[model samples]
Target: MAFPRNGLTSAAPADTRLKLKIARKWTSAEGIVAIDLTASDGAPLPAFTAGSHIDLFLPGGFTRQYSLRNDPRERHRYAIGVLREPGGRGGSAYVHDRLNVGDLIDTSRPRNAFELDETAPFSLLLAGGIGVTPILAMAYRLSSLGRDFEFHYCARSADRLAFRDEIEASAFAGKVRFHLDDGPEVQRLSLDRLLAYRPAGAHLYACGPSGFLDAVVSRAKPGWPADAVHREYFANAAPKAQSDQPFRITLASTGRSFDVASGRSIVEVLADNGIDIPVSCEQGICGTCVTRVVSGEPDHRDLVLTDRQRADHMTLCCSRALSAELILDL
Candidate 1:
């Protein structure tokens, strides 16, 4: 999927939707199902990098993002491993219980926020639970390129590890390590030891549950440079704040103003005023509704934006204004 490189906000067109058929589906591990999607016409699908993900549009107006786990070198199909979240908002449950092989579904083009730094001297890839999807793709690319990399996978138990068989059979199996929570203390992952030695020109990437990711990042902060540590979250760490103050937003393009009430989002206010902003995950985890800020400070609540991105842009889905009013480049 091609997007503007200038980091400016623009509405997504309806025609960008792609239809794909489930070519194959099987269980990858306990509570995990691997699904292979191919173009409905049997034509080549768009090429995606290691950490790219496609937004799957499900029934009941649900849109969920899933990381692509297939090897980047392959173009026939895009593979994704989904963990059934019975407690989640219907998306995962629908995917596990309702979706099936040969079913046609709509998805957005692959977008990558967790890109691998191929020029690095060494790479440290970390995964926790079902967060292994993107890391598995990165490992495959690194192995194929013969890059110096180490993949550390952590799970609660041996049976809960997804893609265990694939990792064991991979050509770079020797560079991979597994840590199980039920295993001995010595066999567990030592974050202290892992972050102590900083390999020159090495970059670290991690994806997993919020607590697991926080542990890796907190440990790496004292030793690793800010630019060298990359991470992707499957969900937001903190819940929405209940003390959001009402604010006014002015659209730069049309000079239109809207009043955002407490307990309501900027996007909702815009939509109520006949303005439409393309959005996927309303929880602010995905970067779909990111809009540029022309003036006023924004109280950014999205997990998708980095510190740099927060200076000039804000995700309209959940973010509010820190000032009395905000001017946006809508």
Candidate 2:
């Protein structure tokens, strides 16, 4: 490899942490609310790309991932819109009810699991319900770049839709399309019709409830490339306990050991024994609770680790020990 003429230079490391406070809150729709945040200490914020997300550390040791709905160019603050699913899991429920206006929180610096693929000649964005969060950023970027991109925002009704007026008022007014289930049949988003309109060199990004994403996958599978289809699942069932069998954890660095109950997570067991592990996402989707595994096999249960990462290391927040006895780094 050749070095630059201005002497050896390395790329700047990405910022991976943010200390922020809830700056403002507004109800976007019937069940959705938007939360804006800013640095509590007036420090410079990190830059992020479209389709990025931040790991929010909520109270009661709960961590969840939310996409950055606001534009990434504005660095003074960040914003995210969350839907309160009453019948769903507890994360959104707590954020809607318990999170106050001035609460301080720790967030992982923006990470992009879904990125805009600019190489394509054009793009098609399909958002089901709150899945619009990530794709909205893509729409903003595409509009700014003068690219040919279209968006289909689908929801049950107009009142349930998020950012309806703002999106319609933007420059993307002509490019954006709304599909309501209660509207006329021709106005609803049709998988068959969308499939027929698929253009060459167009990437399709979809996110939403499990059923919606499943339909997209079922309809677009045989024709779409693996990289062309991007999806995120919002309807994940809470992870269950391993079994009734108990296990022992030995701290390799400190030569200390502890017993972990079958129903308890490694984080819970360690916290009970005075071990503090900094974590944000407890569902295993965020790599915040990653710890070195000294010995013994790990029973991986989290979605954060890739197949290759699971083969190498493990997440301690949700992943538990599969072996009867295991060794861990402090």
Candidate 3:
């Protein structure tokens, strides 16, 4: 490797963990509402790409991830939509019923698990319900580049559709289509026809509920290349493992080993042994506790890791070991 003659110049990400306040809030749909967040200190916020999400540090010590819906080119404000999930674990309820405009909030810098492939010749963006948040951002970027792209939004009804006004007034308004289940029979999103078309070097992105994303992924699997398809999930309801057994966690650096009981979790056992790994969303939805596997097989139970990525890493917070002894890159 050769160093640059200019003595290595690079830009570090600006601090986004600043004191943030909700500058504005409005109802976007029947159950969804949008909020605009700005730094209270009046400093520029961190730059974010399309499909990025930020962690909201809310009351009751709850942290949740919400996608950025506003234009990525702007640094002054970030917009996100929240769907009140009555069955949720209290995060959405807080945003809908308690959290308010002008209230100071803590937010992490944007992180993207579903990234847009900018070099693609054409793109297809699909959003189901509130999943339109990140997809809308991509639409903004695509329209700015003068690129060829199509945006499809699927919802049970027009009332369930968020950001309809913004979409109608956008530069790519002609490229947008709305699929409502309650509308005409011909208007509902037909996966049979939608997944049948494949443009050369075209990419597809989907986000929404788990069932919605699963439908899109399964339908496009046969036609779209695996690398060309991207999807993101807001929450995961992974089933409990029925075949869990006792296993060993061996730290690679210290050669320390800990016995993990079948009834307990890896994170609990690790913390008892004086080793703490960052943990968030212990339900295996968040990728915060993912750890590298040096040796042994993992009975991967996380929602974030792909089949290829499961070969070397596992989420320590919820995942368990398949082998009797597993070595971790601690």
Candidate 4:
């Protein structure tokens, strides 16, 4: 029920699940649905920054996260764009099929893992597909600050690009460039073209599909400074992790215990046992799965917690206990 210290909030306890009523739904291109929403009760909600995402608890026990695409300063409502991924595990299907205007849905409060660094001299943004959601916010902020920046957005085509007009109308539009897969190869962004502008003080941020991210990362390695490159993958990274090893989790509050099999995560195990713990992006970026360690060390595999946070609290969703037994603040 408590909010995250890093300015993230969840639905109120009594309202553990807030109803998201669609105020408007429009297709950005051919298939992508840009959903704008307001709480059904029409009450004020917690504010969020760019790169913040919310957990939508859908039917069939599915929880999918979508980044906030609208200006973060607007506290009255939330907006997100969902691409109908037929290959996806039904998350996008429900968004495009069952959801509609006036439909009430359960959703989590805003939580952010991808955030912009205000101190950076300039920003170079790369967006692919729906990955543009968070970068869109950074563009807004950087524009307001009058920071020098450039946005290279690549999508299959113009129709698939979300908020094309708005992004162009933004104060940062002069620096914005669009690349369509259907266009000639020279028009698309390549390491060769982007690296030319990678000045000494510029910071590069990229987000998109794994293939696109990999391409960007490979291209950036040559000339970009180590600290200047930052990337966010909307999907989980490759699981180089070994097979699961069963472990024991001891809860300090009630002295309860549970067994976390190698096949499942601690968060999933706890949730199955009716334990109430807040979590989003169960893959690890959201930091919603953070819990204090009572005893023993953690394996610390999640991306949410920093080196300092891992020395203090650990993220239980993707991280596991490294020691024989571990105690946590359940």
Q: Rank candidates by lDDT, best first.
A: 1, 3, 4, 2
lDDT of the structure predicted as candidate 3:
0.81
TM-score of 3: 0.89
For 218-240, candidate 2 gives per-residue lDDT tens digits of: 78877876567776666333355
Which candidate number would show the highest lDDT if scored against the true structure? 1
**Each model's lDDT:** 0.84, 0.73, 0.81, 0.75
Compose the digit string of candidate 4's lDDT tens values, residues 1-330: 011121122222436667778889888766778888898888887788877788777777667788887777787788888877766677888889889898888887777777777678888999998888888888887877778888999888777788898898887788999988784543566667777657758888887887887788778888886557776776656463544667799999899999888767787788788876766566666666788998987877765554666776887767887777789977
lDDT of 1 by residue, 69-156 (tens): 8799888899999898866767777888899999999888888778899889899999999989999999999998889999999999
Which model is ahead, 3 or 4, in terms of TM-score? 3
What ranges in model 4 sit over 4 Å off?
1-14, 41-43, 184-186, 196-201, 221-228, 248-259, 269-275, 291-314, 321-330
**Model 1: residues >4 Å from true position, as ranges?**
1-14, 183-186, 239-242
Question: What's the TM-score of each model vs. the native?
Answer: 0.91, 0.70, 0.89, 0.81
Error of 2 at 244 (Å): 14
Residue 59 lDDT in candidate 4: 75
Candidates 3 and 4 compared: the better one by lDDT is: 3
lDDT of 4 at 303: 50
Candidate 4 C-alpha error for residue 137, in Å: 1.6
Best model per TM-score: 1
The lowest-lDDT stretch of 10 consecutive residues in candidate 2 is: 1-10
